[model samples]
Structure formats: structure tokens, C-alpha cells
Target: MLRNIVLLLLLCLIYSLEASDSDKCVTVNVNNLNDLVLKTFRPKPCMTVNINGSGKMEILSSDKFKTPLSNTPLAQVRITGGTFSIDPNFFKQYRHSLDVVTLENNNIPKLGYHVFQDLILRQLELRSNNILFLSNPFYNCSIYNLDLKHNKIDHLSDITFSYTRLFHVNLANNSISIIEPHSFPDTVITIQLSHNLLSSIGQNIFSNLFNLVLLCLAHNRLEYINFEKSDLGKLEDLDLSFNSINNLNQAGFSSLRNLKRLNLRNNHIKSISATNLQTSKLKILDISFNFFINFPHASLPESLNVIYVFGNPWNCKCLFDIEDSFSGNVVSNTMDCKLSQIVNAPICISYGGLCVDDRNNTLINAFSKEVSLYSNDCRDLLQNVIFDYEH
Candidate 1:
């Protein structure tokens, strides 16, 4: 009839190109449990499952993932370096069809209560395990990112992420000291808790992180921080860098006031009590290598645009009153002026280490340029000249 209608349209275009390459993703090497139920009969189902480094596959219980991902439609599950012991309803028959679950370098030490109940996950990478205990392991999930970095988690009880909808919670390095008060989950918006072994942090712990925006308590052992009675007020980046914070109470951070990048670098901060210098959206203020000799600079906040105050001990008249209190902002050379020392002229010169102005004794390369305490001359030095820390 026309060569049998062109051979039935070339066999229906080779069965629609083999059903679009069998619906795209279907890798497999599941080792045990009958090779994960023969990959759901391989006509198109599996959507990612690398049961990584499979040897000694110990996925004890949950009926070996209920008949192999019952009605397979999985969308990502790595289970790295196995020795797995994930029971508590091991993904309860792929509830709500998974959407990303890494389970890294396994040896999971703890995690029971509702181990990710009724899932709708969108990322749950349990990094380098040995997790020490964190009760409520996500229930009725709607998770949108929860890493749990380098585990060994110490403590963080109270309703730990109650009724989930998490936005991002890294928990860096871990060995967490403690944090019970409403454990976090006010639709979290970034929470790192860097390094860890937190020395202090209670003032209603973060009162319900009202949409917090980045709060990484860097390298911990924190000496103190009492954010004016909690409720992070939409915090915006507040990394208490390398801690041991010496002093900063004036209401610590006066409820953050939409803070904008305030890292308090290398701590033991000598002082900073201008009633907590309430941040009016501060813009970059590092307070490098602390132990300041003076730094209130008119209680800060004029929307500063970069202020590091190089490694402390500054007292060349408190760096000429922080160059007449941020004359017009932007200044960089990052002082060191040989750690400046001459409180009352004990013969100071310092060049490579800066500071040398005993009334034009010159050598003031305060890093080298970018000065303006009312148009430079290096801010007309000699404000009762001072500087001492040569020890």
C-alpha cells in the first residue's frame, strides 16, 4: 500500500528514540537488598542512587527501603562511604518522593526521632558523620538546606527545628556547646556556628531568629555577647570572628538593627561600649586582631564603609582620634606602624612598621596612602602624641 506506509513511520521513530533515552537518569550499583530490587525493573524509574562506596552495606531496617523505593521515582540519594545504621523509618518508603539526601562519610552516631519524617526535602547533606546527638531529626520535612558540617554535634535541644521549613543551617565543624532555647527554625535564613565549642550564648539564644540573615559565630569559645535581649531583628551578617571577646556590652549589639557586616576579627576586644553603638546598617567593620587602645570613634554608625583598625595597640593619640573620627570614611593602609610606641616620646621612629611624626619626623607610611582626616598631611599629627606597645 505504499511500501506498507513507509514501514510504519520508521517503526515509530525507533520507539520515540528509545523513550527519550529511558527517561534520563538511572544509575545503579546498589550491591545488597537484591541490588535495590533490580533497580525497579529498569524500564525507567530510578532518578539517582549511588549508594557510594557500597562495601559492607549496612542499611539496617526500614525493610530495606520498603521494597526498593516502592514505585521508584527517587530523585537523588548518595549515602556515601557506608556503614549505615539509619533505622527510624529509613525514609519511610520514600515519603513525598525524595529530592536530595547525601548522608556523607558515614558512621552516623545518632539521629533517631522522626529521622526525616514525611519528606519533601530539598537538600540534607550530613557531612562527615559521627554525629553526637541531636534529637528531633527533622519531622514532616520541607527542608531547604541543612548541612550539619563535620559532625560530632554537642547540643541544641528544644524543639530543634520544630515543624520544619528550614532555609539554611550549616553547623560548621561542630562540637557545639549548647543552645536550647527554641532551637532555631523560624524559617531560618542562614546559621553557621563556625568551628565550635561555644563558650557563651544565652539571651534567649536568638529568640526565634526572625528571618536572620547570616549569623556565623566564627571559631568559637566566645567570651560574651548579649544582643540586647534577642530577636535578631533581621540580622545581616554578624560573624564574631575568632573568639574570646573581651568586652562589648552596652547592650552588646542592641538587637542587631539590620546589622551589615560586623566581624570583630581576632578577639579579646579591649572595649566598645558606646551603648552598643547601635548599627544603623553598618558597612564592614572588622576590628582586626583586638585589644584596642581606643575605638569609639563617635559611637560608630554613620554607615561606615570599611574600617579594620589594624591589629590593635593603636594609641598614637588613639591614631589621632581614629583620624579625627572617620573624617570622611574610606581609609586603608592597615596600620602596624611597628605597633607604634611613644606615649610621650621615648624616641620613636618606625618606618616599615610605620609611625614617625614627632612633628614632621616624617616616615608615616600608614600602610601607604588613602588618608583623609580632613585632607591628609596625614591628619596634621600631634594631638598630644601617643603610642605604646613595644613589648
Candidate 2:
């Protein structure tokens, strides 16, 4: 094991050195952008072009901002610092031999409608730009991964992402409130829409995405959900934690039959029904930190291997019953554990004494004392939470 670790460290060091040596940057300004194209921009192979103190980043413009490096093989381009306003046909010339493009930590007020039209890039990242609104920008591009997180985007117009080869799209950490119908195309596989202002979404917003798998809507203002309206039959992982959801349909994601993991923690759910899990393929479930008074009456899904249920006003009597049922033995342990963690366990048997239902709703302070769970995903007790923090 020590030898393996040493070998891995050596490989990491080699890779880091190679990566550091491959970067090529040129300090650019407005006046010298046109003059430095052939002389300083394209010589052999440039991995990255760092635009310092940017004003006009239209490097591939029509008149003077023509494609500078049509001969050299450029891998990536990152424009950082200052503010920029992109124009159409920005990258009209230098489209070949480009794999990734990033524009981060800049103040971009408006994105050119067809800046990346028909480009064959692999990844396009526009992070921390503080963009307020957006519409269908990409047109017939072969880009697969797109990142637009940490912006102030407030709305999503129809076909927000044009029909392209995009697979993974990240729109997290925005103040998005309105999402027009068919905003997302059917080609996307994963979409990150966490930390937004979505109180509700139209049923057909995700209707055409048949190949989507992972979807995150955590830290939103959603109160109700009817997944049956959403035709996401192939989704596997879903995150709905840290919301204001109080009403969930008992039919339980009629279209999410292939769902393996579900997170509904840190909400205001009163009671849940397990009848929907009978026909579904859920493996991990988290319903912690809610307003559950008693465990659901119906048995959990047989395919479930792990379930998280803690930090709620659970009736000790119900947990005892569930423990007896799960262990197939009599209930003996009545001491409530402050927090619980176990492997391959049924809905956890964390004790919290009698529930509000048992005491005729007199213990108002019991709800105030309910703990909040640390889990936001079913695969692990802790998630990265990068999408939850302020961006």
C-alpha cells in the first residue's frame, strides 16, 4: 500500500508539472488586442489565453478582432478580471482545435446571442458573471458540458439551452424565479438548478427530457411537487432538501419509476405514504428533519437498502414498532440517541419520546427542538454543499 501511495504521488507530481508547463498566457488590453494577434498570440501551441483587465474580449471579431491563432492548436481559453461585453461572432475565427473556454470572475452584463453558435468546443464555463437574465444562446453547438453557476440570472426563457449536444448543465447559485416551458432541451443528461428561487415549476418544463438522470433542486422555495406531470422516467438521483415543501403527492413520482435515490429532508412534511415505493426501484431514501409525527404505515420498498429518518418529532412507539419489524425481535432499547448512523439499516430508530399526535398537539416546543440533519443526499450522509453556499 505504501508503494502504491508513493507511485500515485509521483504520477500526480508529474501531471501537475506537465499541466503547469502547458499554460500560455498573454496580458491583453483594448488597444493592443488587434496588434498582438500574429506577433504574440499565435506562435506554436497555446493552452490558455488570460485576458487581463478586459474591456473588449471580442478577440475573433470581424474587422480587427479576427481569429488570431488559426494555425496554432489551442486547448483552452480563460478570460479573467475586469468587465466584458461580448458581441456576436466573438469566436467566429478561432473555432478549430479548441476544447474548453472559460470566463470567470468578470462582470458580463449581456451575453451575445450567438457567441458560441456552431462551435465545436467541449466545455464552456461562465461562472460568477452576475448575469441577470438569459435566453437561447447556443445554436447548433457540439459543446457537451456547460457551467453557468454563481450568477444573478432571474429567469429562463424557452429553449434556454438550444438543441445541441449538451449533456451536463450547471445553473446553480442563481436567483432564478421563472422558468418557461421547454426551457431545457431533451439532450441534457444532468441539470443542476439548486439554490434558486423556484417556488414551483410547470409540469412540462422537464417533460421532454427522457434521458435526464441527476436533478438537484435543493435550497429552493418549492412547496408542492407532482412528478407524475414530469415525464422523467429515467431519473436516478434527486435532491429536494432544504426547501419549504409541505405537501407531497402520495402517488410519489409516478414517472420516476427508475429512481434509486430520493432526498426529501429538511422540509415541512407531516406524513408520508410508502404505497408508491411498492412498484418503484428506490434504494436510498432520506426523509429526515421534517415534521413527521409517526412512521408511515405501509412498509418501505424492498429494494431500499438505506433510509435516513431522524431530527423530527417521531413517536417513540412507532420507532419501537419499526425496530421490532426491522430486526425481527422485541423492542428493548428505548434510550433516544441524539444522532444515529448505521449501515444497511431500515428507517432509523432514533427516539424522541411521544409525538405531537400522541399528546393532542400540546407540545409546541417539541417542534422547535427538532434537530436538522446533515444529509442532503442518499449516497452519503454529507454532500459537498458547494451549491448551497453563497456564490
Candidate 3:
């Protein structure tokens, strides 16, 4: 019985020793990667985790503790479902692909300059983090898609995407108010900037994004959008709805040659006089829920299949005859006339084009009488009347 008890004690001791050994450091390294890659080697100050008596791993800051090492490479470390803060020097030293970096529901409060700079990453999803400012976030990253949405970023500075090739970026639902020019450099295909406080877009803001196809800026506070005269050459779909666009000048939309669909619903547009509009393949134009005293008379192409000009106070007297004569392929009868009686009036008798207004015959008669009395020789007649008074 004594020998059996001693054997049991030895086994327990051995198990405890094994467990302690297993709780030590684990290094990961990827071999034979490109020399110029950003994350080619293990990041010094990457992380140092200490195991406690209760089997809990505690991460120590660089100033607090040091980690043991055996010349180990760090391409094999898997840190999923755990809390780990990225070292500030991680991207500064190594510049290679950090493939499959998944940090779901992590609280990385602070990030340094060029934190992910010059790295070639396959996927990086830093969703649900409390990261407020990412200065030069992707200084030089070649990422496929970067989703930093749901972060608390407010201001976006210039060269934010210094040298990144981002395919799909979701910056929706943030407090981003100002977007200085050249904020997004290089090629970005799909960009989602919805649900923000972007009031204006300066010229050449989207000029460097040569490969952009889908640009979503809906649900913003944009009042003016002025694009320069360069062909947005590959743009397909653009969403500017749910905004405060009061006046859309010709300069604001000169170079959208390949644009297919445009959503301008729920805006404050009182008129639209488009010049050189036949340059685009616009199939859908939605101008609903606003004021439209005059819409562009430029004959829209036959490719236009849907036009939602409803819920606007359309002047019936001026536009009724024109809309009736128009041969456009699509028309939305939902455009309610503000002035019903004036809409049915003849267009030839009234020369000034006023979208239909209320049938205030008294005001109309007063205006016509003033015009007739002042017709042609009013200045001469005034002089004669003064001369008679002098005599």
C-alpha cells in the first residue's frame, strides 16, 4: 500500500510538470517569404504573456516584463479567441502579409502611426473595436478587403490610404465629418461611406481611385459635390440620396461618363439644368421628395428606364406641356402637381417658364398690367410727362 501510494504521487508530480512546460511560450514563423515583405519576421515586442497559478494568461506591457526566446520563428502562432494587443513596432519592423488576422470583439484602445503600414494582408477585420483615430491607418498595405467599420473614427485626414490597394472598404456608421482631398489614394473598387456627416466633397477627392466601381455615399449631410473634369472613367453606380443637396451645378457632374445608375432621392433640389448629360449610360434617375420647379430639358437617352420625380411641387403650367410632348421611355406619374388649375393652362400664351403654381388670377393680372404699361416707350413717356409738368 505504501509503494502504490508513492507511485500515485510520482504520477501527479509528472503531470504537473508537463502542464507547466506546456504553459510556456509558443513561437510562430513563416519561412521563405519575400525579403521585401513587411511582416517577414517576428515582431520584436510582439507580445509577452505570463501564465498564472490559476491557469490564466496575462499579457504584460513592454515596460513591465520580458519574454523568453529560443531563436524561434513566429509564423505558426495562432491567437484566436483571446485578448492580444498588437505591438507598436510590429508594422514598423516587418512588412509582410499577416494573413487571416481576426480580432473580433476586441478592445484595442490605442493604435500608432502606420500600424498596418506596408503590409500585404489577405483579410483584416477589426470590427467592434473602440479605436477612435487611425493616423495613416494603412500607410502602405496591399489588402484585399479591410473592414474597420463600427469604429469611433470621426475625422479623416489626407493620405489616410497612402499606399493601400483596398478592394472593399466599409466606413459606414461613423462620425466622419471632414474628408480632405486625396483621403483615399490608389485603387479602391468598392467604398461604402454611408450614414455619416460628410457635408461636402472637394474636387479630385475620388480622382486617384481609378478602379472604383461602386461608390456609396448615401445618408450623409452633403450639400455640394463638385468633381473635376476628369473621366471618372470606370464608375458604374453612385448613391447620393438621403442628403441635403440643394444645388447640383454642371461642374459637379461633368465627368461621369460611365455612370449607370444615380440615386438623388430625398434631396432639396429646386431645379436641374444638366449640360452634357448624354455622356453617361444613366438608366435610373430618382428625384423624389423635393422641390422641382424645373428639370433638365436635355433629352435623356433611351437607356433611361425608370424616373421617380414624385412628391415634388412640380409647376404644372410650364412643365405639363413639355412633359406631355416628351418621348422619354420612362415617366413617373407620381409627380403631384402643386398647382392643379395652372397645369391645365395653355403654354404658348405664357412665355416665361414657371412650373405650375396656384391659379391666383388677381396676381397674374396685376403682373401682366404692369408689363403692358411699361412696354417699350416707358422712358420716353416718362420724360414727356416731366416736360409737361415743367411747362
Candidate 4:
């Protein structure tokens, strides 16, 4: 009976050893994936699995994590420097506990439909890939932050992120030229679409983004904007610089009552209507390097703390009234014109020699002297006529 007990204890020890080996984190190299099924390379329960190398790996349907047989699921899976074409259900076994998945610097050409379905993934980084189109790949996932920067995606269809609760999405440095209306969820806060080929945007493209705060659309080909239809009531910062915009209407900015900073540098704008200065909460306005010949002083709101109007062909006389009507602390134009000189002359001159007269005096001075001489002659003529009538 003692001998039988010894044999049973030895069997228990072997089982415990196998269990311990199955619950440790595993690192799989693509160079050594010699006909081995992916499920046979599972790490211990609730442990991470890091897949490394640059070779291609096909994740078939039969290949899955061994976490389903155990109580704990995989914690995280990070696949770097590989061309992985994974099936939609490849991660079905670790749906409950997988929190983070990063696939950076990969050659993923496409993602299958419902690829991340039923997973509680919090963050997914798929940067620097060759993804051409963005379909509904992340269905039923509550991803908070998604990074898809430096990809080849050119368009985003409607309801692309309708199934997810995404808050921040970075789609910068892509070839995106079109965005279907309501493509983003209403819960999104910050969206970066800079350095793209977007020549124009739809009127109601951002209509549903009620919680959007920061939107970066710089380095694009946009020539005009219609914010009245965008419904960005809560947006604080808007960057539309480095575009081909030549005009701005009052209706385009009437709805942005909460906007603080507006960047319109490096455009072709020659004028800004006074009605566009209705935003009471605007603090900083950058309109540098444009074709503005006049600065609208009376139209500028008193709430503005700083304004950049440098690198434009500005009329020097426009600065006189800008310095007078504005309370000195409100308008801040970063031009080469000195406010002290402007205050003394009380005349307007163009910085680009547009106001220079033949006598080397400013056109403002010549006009002022002409008005003074004409008034004196009229008074002298009236006195002479009164003397003749009395005689």
C-alpha cells in the first residue's frame, strides 16, 4: 500500500510541473515558427505574449490562445515587425481579459470584418502600416485611444466607428481625401487629420461630434470652410493653417462660440469681414503671411488678447484706428510697424509702399495738406465777397 501511494504522489508532481509551464509568458520568434500551431505556443494563464520578427505569419481559425480552458485569459499581446494576416476569430479565446494589443511597424494590408469583436480592448496601435481602407474592423470594442498615423488610408466611410466608444483618434499623415458624414462616434474628443490630401470637407461632416474639443486639419488643401453646418459648438482650438483658404465669412464661425484659438496662417486671405468677429470667447487669432491690406479694427472683438498680422501687406493707416479703438491691451498685431510712430502721425501708410506719394511723403500726409489748403482759400474768398457787398 505504501508503494502504491508513492506512485500516485509522483504522478501529481508531473501534473503540477506541466501546469506551471503553461502559465508563463512566452516569446515566439517568426524565424523558429517551424510548422508549429500558434495555440501550442501559449504563455501561462493571464500572461503576455510577444511575437517578434519580420516574416509573414498567417493566423488560421484553429490557432488560438489556450486561455479558454483556464480561468484567466491573456493579459496583453504585442506583435512587432511582422506581416500578420490574422483571421477575425484569431483572438476569440482571449476576448475577456485582453486589454492592450499593439501591431506597430507591420505590413498589414487589410483587417477582416469584426476582427476585434467581443473584446474589451482599451488601446490599439496600428501605426506605420499599409492599410488602404478603414472598414468596420473593430466591432463591439470600447477602445479609448486608437493610433492609425502614417498609414496609406485615403478615405473613411460612414459608421466606421459606430460600434466602438472611441474618444481620441489620430489619423495624421495619410492620403485621406474623403470622410463620410457621421464617420466618428459622438464620444470622440480629439481628432488629428493633418498632413493629408483633403482639398475640401463636407458641410455637415462634424455635425454629430458634440464632445469634440480639439481638431487639427493643418497642412491640407482646404480652400474654404463652412463651420455653421459642422455643429462644433464646444470646439476650443481649431488649426486650419497651411491651406489655400482665401476668404472667411461670418456664417462660417458664428456657431463656434466656445472657440479660443484660430490658426489661419499661410493662406491667401485678403480680407476678413467684421461680422466674423462675433465670437465672444476668442482670445488668439493668427492670420499671418496673407494678402491682407487692411486690418478691421472696429470689427475686432474686445475679448481678443493677442492677434498675429505679420508678413502681410498692411496699410499703415489701418494701424492708427486699430491702436485707437482697441483698448491697447485687447489687439496685439505682430507687425514691423511701431505703435508709437503710428500714434504720433495719426495717418495710414502701407507697409508694401502702396501709400507712397510722388513727393516722398506718405499718401496720408499729402491728402491732409491738400484738404488744409482748400479750406483756407474758401474762407478768404468768402471775406472778400462780404467786403465788396458792404462798400
Winner by TM-score: 2
User: Scored by CA lDDT, what does every candidate get?
Assistant: 0.67, 0.65, 0.57, 0.67
1-391: candidate 3 lDDT, tens digit per residue: 9999999999999999976665454433222111113233234323222221232232313222212222322221233333345555554333442354444444555455677766776667766666677767676678777777777778776767766677777788777898766677556777788788899887767777777777777778999887655347777677787789888765355477777777777677776656635645877777655566456644565577766654455555455644664555656644233222234322223325655543334433432344244434432221110000000
Give the Å shift of residue 104 in candidate 3.
3.6
Q: For model 2, state the Cα shift of residue 144 in Å.
A: 1.6
Candidates arranged by TM-score, highest first:
2, 4, 3, 1
Q: Candidate 1 residues 159-257, lDDT tens each?
A: 766787788888989899988887887888888878889988878888878887778888789987787778888777788877788877743685688
Per-residue lDDT tens digits for candidate 4, residues 1-391, read 9999999999999999988777556665543222334344434444333445446655534243332334456666666555667678767767877777777777777776888777776778888868876668878778777899999988887757768887878898999999888998887888888889998766788888888888888878998677777778888788887778887863377588888878876677777877787788987887765666576657766778777665455566665455566656545453333322333322334556443222223443443444344435432221110000100
Candidate 2, residue 63: lDDT = 46
The residue ranges of model 4 lying beyond 4 angstroms of the native Cα positions read 1-28, 32-57, 60-72, 323-391
Each candidate structure's TM-score, on Cα atoms with residue i matched to residue i, is 0.33, 0.77, 0.62, 0.73
lDDT of 3: 0.57
Q: Which ten residues in a row have the lowest lDDT in candidate 1?
A: 382-391
